[model samples]
Target: MQKRLANFDLDLALNVTESTLGILGGSGAGKSMLLRCLAGMESPSKGQIVLNGRVLFDAKSGINVPSRDRRIGFLVQNYALFPHMTVAKNIAFGLPKALSARQVRQRVEAQLAAVQLQGYGDRYPIQLSGGQQQRVALARALASEPELLLLDEPFSALDTHLRSQMEQEMVTRLRTFNGVSLFVTHNLEEAYRVCQDLLVLEQGHAVAYGAKYDIFERPGLLGVAQLTGCKNISAAAEIAAQTVLAGDWGLPLQVVDSIPDRLAYVGIRAHQIRFTEHANQCNTVPCWLVSTSETPHRMTVFLKFNTQPDHPQDYHVQAEVFKEKWEMLKQKPLPWFVQLDPLRLMLLEA
Candidate 1:
């Protein structure tokens, strides 16, 4: 069974158990919706969500179990701490009271220690900094000892340096949980750095879901291509039928790949465009220098083109090179031959 999301269009129906799948997408891509659906925070209009051999939600089968029994620990965005409660109380909230006072105190103490907040137990949420408070949230979630963990934008609140630090800590701690961990984040770099597998979403659909390397190198679909930052995309026929790229540059490119005559998008990374010494013999073209910005370690050169037969806005190609390249050809505006690898030019279906 399946139903449409409020704003995004997706047909999310799958059984996730024991595998930690990282969902990376921009906001409102239904990543959190699916998680909430699974957790029973938001009921699905249709479809079924199963976790660890338990039937959580089923439309036609009519078997539904609420979130509590599903054994899912969710760390939502914004930490969601109890402002008035002490840190220890927040973590202890998840444990059963049937345990003696000694046992409860022992568990909370252990959790606080794990999150590096050993003695911050008596302090309320306001007394703790944002990072420390988030630690409390994470500690509380893990305190439940759930079989599945769902973290949504878990590190967005922290500063860059703190975020990196927490990620290392979380990965090491989560390793021993022995349960499925589904995490969602809009940060591509975070997804790359933290997740073992990636599920790239676009407009509420699973455009690409697989190993992280494959999605970055080849998105396997048009939506995924756009999301993965393929700037120089063009139809496949434009390559075979024509000898150049878009816009007016008319920069002649040799057709190396026997591409099928179909609507497709071809892309090359900005850094991939660079200069070569052999201007006469290389696959170079007559290009004029638009502008240059020199940084301590590198230089970015913008090339103004007369024509790029099929590109948008008469755009200038942005290329980055080492400071040495600028020094080697100092004080001279020169036309360099461009040698673009055919294999580097990815062709994805439009």
Candidate 2:
């Protein structure tokens, strides 16, 4: 819908169609409201919802189709299966009565097999595991053969191991279906795994949206950096052309680009923060060892800084480190250096 949510401080000038459009957000980010609007359960104060070049909700045209006639598949969080019905019957429940009993049975069989539960059709909801029940839910939603499938946290009910398994399963099954899928998930790793593109929402607003790499590599705000787990983040002050970032790590960073003299938020990824004992000079700030941890893949050392060191004034620092170089730091407990990687650190514009 073009500008659907004008009320409640929501001003989404969004575009959509039968394509799978994920209304992703934390709870109360207007995701359900958008879903409701699309399904015609609720109407927008202003805007037009277009589907396949057809207007479903047009305030100007005074057209608001009812939910059932909208032809959409919405699989909600609860999996909403009827306790009494068998999995097969649940899947075929939405099918037209005019279909021959044999046809319905055939479709149900195919759906159960497609969801990798070919023989589970005879079982009731209580008999299936949480993951199995969700598979049936997905099959039921897909059975209707809608233009789009909206899955709201489809894997939430499953445990970590099962969730990962179901993630792969969803990808395989969704590929067979021609329509787009709007799958909601809070797992950052899962989000990175499933989506080629991304839309990050914060406090009822789309704070960032782009390719996954861009959002991770170049975060837009402090919130986004934190959301994506870009570990080192702190406040900095700009001194004319050079921006000075200083924080717990005692490192002072100079802004590579010219920003007006003011305070700004500084962020750098853990992997990007380099620890080099290259020099006892301005850009290299000293950090005292707190403790260190070593794992098979990489080493993580904790350090603290006493005061803000002198700098051309660029960035703030305090983060975990990886690679073999980190191995050397774990042996000692004293002063060290954190050489901020000039290229990778970010200065959020205030």
Candidate 3:
């Protein structure tokens, strides 16, 4: 399907079974647009959508199923619960009206139990905590037993502590969901935690889509590397079958994997950089400390090569050191050696 946003164009062709796929991208990347199309809230400009052998949309065939008829569950970021409805009523809203009152009550009760909110059914949305409200949204989404489930940044509104809790809650629910699922998020860590497969969108394009580990570890595309939280990336030229010159960081990287021809970049996660006392390691480079920023558990150290201080812009590297290691490094002098592990080095095609 194709969607044209103000400044972005989204053209994606995706097919999956009963598995969870995380749609990851920054703002304006069309992640939510894709979900909306699948849910029948937005009609595609062209092409078709078939789910579980049912044609949800077929522009050429002049077929367009209504959102309610499509049986697709969508959990919005803000929970989207009705303030006037109790949790049971909200969940029952998704059930088909053909069901008898007793059947609707049973379905709502089962959904509430599935989300671990058995007795909270009569409680209004405002009476529940943030996490409870989120669970209610999940219960409502699953109440219809949808053929496809779409989650659009469902945890984006929660506090950090609550987000963690809801993430695990969603994980538990997904374990037995029995439907195709797609989760859209801009947060790479959350995507990694929830999805088995990942689809990376950039400016309306599917930059990369594959198993989560392959997509995260060997992102192949420069945009994918940046989106997957790679802090250190440098323009590079292939030096040999297993070597490349990192032009920006002023270092020659020797990777264990074979280097491809026409390589354009090299990427290393900040945490993959190891502190080294010896400067002669295979991928080691002598670096002088530039600055440091500390988080609760780790320190992000900015370093420049002792050899090319003049090219500071290009030679700057970021290395993540644990708080304990950072404290020890602070006791030392200005110069230190850092090693980029060959196994962790990513050779990219840009």
Candidate 4:
């Protein structure tokens, strides 16, 4: 399907089956837009949307199902709950009007139990905490017994501790759900923890899509590498079958994987850089410390290779080390050797 906005145009086709697919991307990357289109909240400019063999949308045939009839549960960002309505009422609002009042009450109670917000249903949304409000919204979404669920940054408004707690709860909820789910978020760790598969979007385009491990381990494109938390990417050219020259770092790396013919970038995670005492280690680079940054439990050491001169951007690599290791390594002398493990190297296209 395709969606054309003023500055961004989303053009992509995807098929999802039974598993939860995480939509991962930065802000304005069309992550939310994709969920909106799938939920029938927005019409696609082209192509067709078929869910459970039902044609929800077909641009060529001029068929567009209304959002109400799509049977999609949408837990939007900020938990779009009715402020004046009680939790039970908010959940019951989504139930079919054909059902009797007693049936609506029963369904609402069941949804409340599913989200672990049973007795709290009598309270208004304003009286609940962020996490509780989120639970209420989830209950409302599932009240209609949707065939698909779309979650858009559902934990964006919660505190760190609460977010983590709710994430575990959400995992349990999704496990019991008998339908496919689409989770949209910019946070990589959250996506990794909650979804089995991933679809990475960049500038409204799907740069990569696959199993979570495969996407993280072998992100094939530069945009996907960045999204997967590859920090030390450099312009590269294939020098040999298994080697590539990392241009920005002025280092040639021997990678475990074959160098792609159209190689445009090489990357390694900051934590993958290993500090070693041996000078002759494979892929070792002797470097001088440029700076050290300390986080609560870790340290970021910036180093420049001996071959690189002292320029403003001469720091060739940033290595993340534990605080204990940093304390031990700081005791050593200058010209420390760091090894770039070939096994963890990421080769990418333009």
Candidate 5:
């Protein structure tokens, strides 16, 4: 699917199988726009969107399905519920118009029970809690037995505690839904917890899309690395088949396999840094302690390379450790040797 806007450009080409797939990107990166295109709420410049072997959108064919007839459940941010309608009426609204009054009531009851809101069906949206209102919205979406589900930051507006609860509830609720579900979220932890596959978008392009584990383990691009929470990235040049000189870290990193021929950058997660006393270890370097910050459960330690202080552009590397490790390290010294694991290192392209 592709769309061109005044400020953003979207170019995505991929197939989504039956599973919960995550669309991860920063704000205005075309996450919601793509969802709208899929829902037939927004037309793409030119592309085809097929669902369950049905052609939903084909520019060349001039076939565009209406949003109401697409049989897709779109759960947007803020729940998108009708404030004036009771929970039962809200859910019943999704029922097909052809259904009889008795059938609509039966279906609404079933949806309420499915979402564990049997007794709250008479309450209005204003009377319900944030989590309950979200459930009502979800129930309405699911009431029609949609062939596909599109969630656009469905839990983003909830409080931190409620958001976590809703995330778990959604996962459980969607387990029985045997269709494709696209979950758009910028929070990596939310995506990691709720999605089976990942689609990483950058500047409206599909930078990386694959199984969740594969995308996390081997993010091939620099943008993907940054999106995956890799705080330490350095310029690099391939010195040999299995080694590359990391210019920012001031070390030559050796990997288990041969490095890419045109490797342009290297990335390591902050938590991947290992403290060691031996300076002779492979890929170990002594760094001057810059500063440290303490959180409730972990510590963020900042360090700079032992290189001369003349290079102000050289950024400090952030290393994270649990409080227990911080306790042991704090008792010892200021200068420490940090080892970069060969297996954990990521060689990336620009």
Candidate 6:
């Protein structure tokens, strides 16, 4: 499908079966636009959308299904719920009008129970907590038994604790859902934990798409490496069949596989940098600490090789170590030996 927005143009073709595909990207990368097109909120400039052998949209044939008739359930970023209606009414709002009142009531009750909000149907959305409000929104989306589910940053508005809790609930719910689900999020960890497959977007174009692990372990593009949380990347030029000069780091790296002909950059995850006692180790570099920063359970140690002059902004690599390891390493002297494992190195293109 292709969509041309004010400053962005999205051009990509995707095929999804009975699986949850996570859309990952930075701001303005068109993650939400893709969801909007699929949900019939926005029309694509061209191409066809066929779901379950039914044509949802076809530009060539001049066919476009209205949003209400698409059988798609969308959970927006804010969990858009009716302020005046009770939870039960919100869930029943999307039910088919042809159904009897008794049927509607039964479906509403079933959905309430499904989302674990059984007896709270009488309460308004404003009366519920953020997590509870999200549950109410989810119940409303599922009440009509949609064939396709699209979630646009559903957990973005929650607190850290609440986001974690809702993510677990969402994982459980998606497991039993019998339709294709498309989840949009800028959080890498959230995407990795919830979805089996991943589609990475950059500037409204798809840079990578495959199983989550495959994309994480071998992100083939510079933008993809950054999006996947690779902290260390350097301009590279092939020096030999299995070696490349990491220009920004002032180091030549040995890779496990033959260097790709189109290599533009090389990367390694922060946690993959190994500390070794011996300077004789292959791909080992003797380095001095530049500085350090800490999270709750992890510490980021910035370092530069002895080959480079001391400068505050010239720290070449940052290694993330567990707090326990950081405590031990801090007791050691200068000139720490770190190894860049060839197997863990990522060769990337522009």
Residue ranges of candidate 1 with Cα displaced over 4 Å: 1-3, 15-19, 96-100, 235-261, 280-286, 291-301, 305-314, 320-332
Cα RMSD of predicted structure 1? 3.7
**Location of the lowest summed lDDT over 10 successive residues in candidate 6:** 305-314
Model 5 residue runs over 4 Å out of place are 307-315
Task: Put down candidate 1 lDDT per residue, 1-350, tens digits, no spaces.
Answer: 34477675567644455666789776777888778877778777777777666778887888778776777788988988888898999998877657788988998888888899998999999998878888899899888778888999999899978898888888877777789888898777777777778887767677788878888776756667666665555543464343445333445455454454553555566567756666664346555566677888888766655433243334456567788877875556555556555656565666
Candidate with the larger TM-score of 5 and 6: 6
Residue pair clashes in candidate 6: none
Ranking by lDDT: 6, 4, 3, 5, 1, 2
Badly placed stretches (over 4 Å) of model 6 are: 307-309
TM per candidate = 0.84, 0.81, 0.95, 0.96, 0.95, 0.98
* Per-residue lDDT value at 227 in model 3: 92
Instruction: Give the candidates in order of TM-score, highest first.
Output: 6, 4, 3, 5, 1, 2
lDDT per residue (tens digit) for residues 226-304 in model 2: 7776777777666445647455444566666454344467777777666776756445666765555566777655555
Q: How many residue pairs collide in each prediction?
A: 15, 6, 0, 0, 0, 0
Candidate 3: segments with Cα more than 4 A from true spot: 307-315
- Report the alpha-carbon TM-score of model 2 versus the true structure: 0.81
Using TM-score as the measure, the top candidate is 6
Residue-by-residue lDDT tens digits, candidate 5, 1-350: 77998887898898988899999987778899999999889998888999989999998999999998999998999888888899999998867899999998888899889888999888999999999999999999898999999999999889989999899889998788989999999889899999999998888999999999988889988899999889999999988778888897777888764577668999888999899999988888877666677888999988787653345444468899999988899887656788988988998999
Summarize candidate 4's per-residue lDDT along 92-172 as a digit string, tens digits. Answer: 887788999899989998988888887987899999999999999999899999999999999999999999999999999
Which is better, 2 or 5, measured by lDDT?
A: 5
lDDT of each: 0.72, 0.70, 0.88, 0.90, 0.88, 0.92
